[model samples]
Target: MPTDTVRYGMISTAKIGINAHIPAAVKSHNSEIVAICSRFDGPAKQAAEENGIGRWYGSYEELLADPDIDAVVNPLPNSMHHEWTIKAAEAGKHILCEKPIAVTMDEVREMTAAAEANGVLLVEAFTHRLNPHMRRARQLVGEGAVGDVRHFEAVLAFTSRDTSTDVRLKPELAGGGLWDAGCYSVSAARFILGGEPVRAAGFAADSGNYGVDTSFSGLLEFPGGAIAHMRSSVEQPGTNMGEVIGTKGKIRIPHLFEEDTPLVITNADGEERVETFAGEPRFVVQFNDFSECVLTGKAPEFPPEDGLANTAAVLALYASASSGQITAVERV
Candidate 1:
């Protein structure tokens, strides 16, 4: 292995790992998927062979114990993210954990503290944040192209046919559309608005049998009078759209989360212009970003504190829904 390259051990053979992270890591010049792990031996062996990984481990502890592996991609279930991430950090393995970071802010703080104490990087894998288009949108907003940013609306929804057995449908596993998709909307709003929300109010519909939220709609109030509306549903047709409106102009992202897409900006003059970005797999970009931070000892663009802020906002939304009152977002 090259001294400049990061040898990665994948902690799970989950769909996201197999379909996105593995391929992304294989394509990254600074990253190598040296090993993959699954609790079951058969799946671990199959993933290793299918993904061209050098080795397979039936247990996560085995992969973590490997000295040659520099990092681990933790795409485990929501409930397992905190535990495994802490363990990975304790093992001196940099981690790219999946979104929402954790179901609660306390868990996020713990994971971040462990990583800091162990001298390992722990980044929340919000792939959309790595997209050039998203970065450009934020730049435009910050530059006042959308003057006096006042409002935002984002929706990310998808219909799930396998709700009965999907991990996303289990309450104990922290399954819900809000945690799965709504977090993206909330995080995007915070990013575009340039601050954390001060208050949040929302409503959620539960999956009767599972006691998990199938749909949620929320409103967040940021400092300086900026407001955002976010919606997510596991029972609706897929849609990904985000809009940021200001006094002078507005920006609309048709495919907010997708990698290759055009951003439409409309000004007060009723004139509109399109901004297009080079198509790059966001997962690949995310992995490369993590690799750069690991190699250079630089803090990640989206660090654990940002993850905690996002988690705090989401938790406030949940509290609002539960209490039927506007809930204050706890600052990290």
Candidate 2:
């Protein structure tokens, strides 16, 4: 291994690891997938052979014990995040875990505690926040480009393939439209408004069929009097976009969580302008940033602590959905 380059053990042959991170690792100079692991030997061996990884293990423990690996990328199902992430931390490996970090506030605390105890870097994979589009949007809101942001709308919807077996549709896995997609909207609202919501109201547009939400809508009220209406779906098709409306203007994000997107701002006088960024995959950028953080000990702009607020707000919304009333955000 080259000095300062982070060697990763890719956990599971999950489609996301193969389709997104593998390609991203190829493009990253300081990051490499040195190994891969699955619960069975055959799949691990096949994935390793096909991907050109030098090492493959049948168990996560074996993968973690490999001295050649410096970190792990855990893209397991939502419910598995807390378990495997803590395991990776205990093994003295830094981690870049999938979004919605954990399903509950207690799990978030436990994961954070384990990482801090082990002196490992643990980051939630909200890669879009690392993109320039979101960075600039947050800046614009702060600079009054969207004067006194009063209202916002965010939506992320897509049709899933093989819903019967897809991990996203399983309730026991902590899967649902809100956990899979709406977390982005809630996080975006927090990012753009630069404040946490005081209260949240959620309504399940679709539920009971799968014991999880297929489509859902949520309303959040921020401390600064900003209101956000967000919708997410796993069984329907819709645009991935966000709009922040202010007293004097509004800013729009077309691809809310994708790296290759632009920001469109409209002023009180009806003038509009679009802000564009060069094309790049947010995941690739995230892969490289993980290495940078490992080697240089620099904190990510959106660190794991930031994810706590995100998970808390989502939990509040989930509680609201269940109780049939607006609920106060836990911390507020």
Candidate 3:
């Protein structure tokens, strides 16, 4: 690899890869999508040609073995995240992995250790942190626009009648509305609260097949007595939004995570404010941040540690739901 070029590789033709990440990588400055791999050759080759990428492979291992690839994006299913991330680390390739870093805390710990040992930068792509609007909301919360934050409210849901056994609904595939959508709510709550959640109380509905939750609602108690109530579901219609209400004033991210418009704020004086990210690409922002971290050896704002914390909160919620009691998140 030369100092003049940013060589990129992708591990899947997943929907996110095709729709969001690949386009962002191509549009990024001085970077090229060198190679991509998929279990299926048809889609992989099509995606490579359609997206103007250099080459396509029918397997992930071959892509990892390519020395020309400076960085690899892991857009595989949640269950496969740890295995391939470790492989990428071993191959000395910088990695940008999708959210919910791993299915378990132990797995996250192992992946983090491997990245550190292999000396490759590993980042979890949580696009909300890169959103300028969310950045402003964090600043407002820090500035005490909302007096000492007491309770937070977050909800994300959409209707999905598709019963084709997609990854989101299969426990084996690490699919669930919680991992699919709730990860965003948990990440937002953790981001705004600026600390790990200590306890969680939750309830989950079963689809009666694989035991994966179709919907989950939970309460996260952070340090200093701040509490966040969150919910996510695939059985609903359209998108639901979230809010961080403090004592003095409050910031309302009408929609968290996804490229939301018109983030609003209301103060005790009855004045209203809005922060807008005008015509911005959400995944592009995330790709830029990941590229900077890889190129400059900088720490990403949301790292694997943040992913671990969110996973802990999620596991605790599931446990609470099973036991019919509030469960505490053990520090990872």
**Which candidate ranks first by lDDT, i.e. highest?**
1
Local distance difference test, each candidate: 0.90, 0.89, 0.83
- Which ranking of candidates, highest TM-score first? 1, 2, 3
Off by over 4 Å in 1: none
Candidate 2 residues lying further than 4 Å off, grouped into runs, are none
Candidate 2 lDDT, tens digit per residue, 75-135? 9999999999999999999999988899998899999999999999999987667778888
Query: Which residues of candidate 3, in runs, are more than 4 Å off?
Result: 258-260
- The sequence of per-residue lDDT tens digits that candidate 3 reaches over residues 53-103 is 888998899899999999888888899999999999999998888987888
Kindly give the number of clashing pairs for every candidate.
0, 0, 3
lDDT of 1 by residue, 1-332 (tens): 35678899999899999998888887897888899999989999998998789999999999999999999999998999999999999999999999879998889999999999999999888887667788889999989998998899999999888877888888888999899999999988988778889999999998566788899999999888888999999989999999999999999999887777889999999899999888678888887888988898878888899999999999999999999999999987
lDDT of 2: 0.89
The deviation in Å at residue 106 for candidate 1 is 1.4
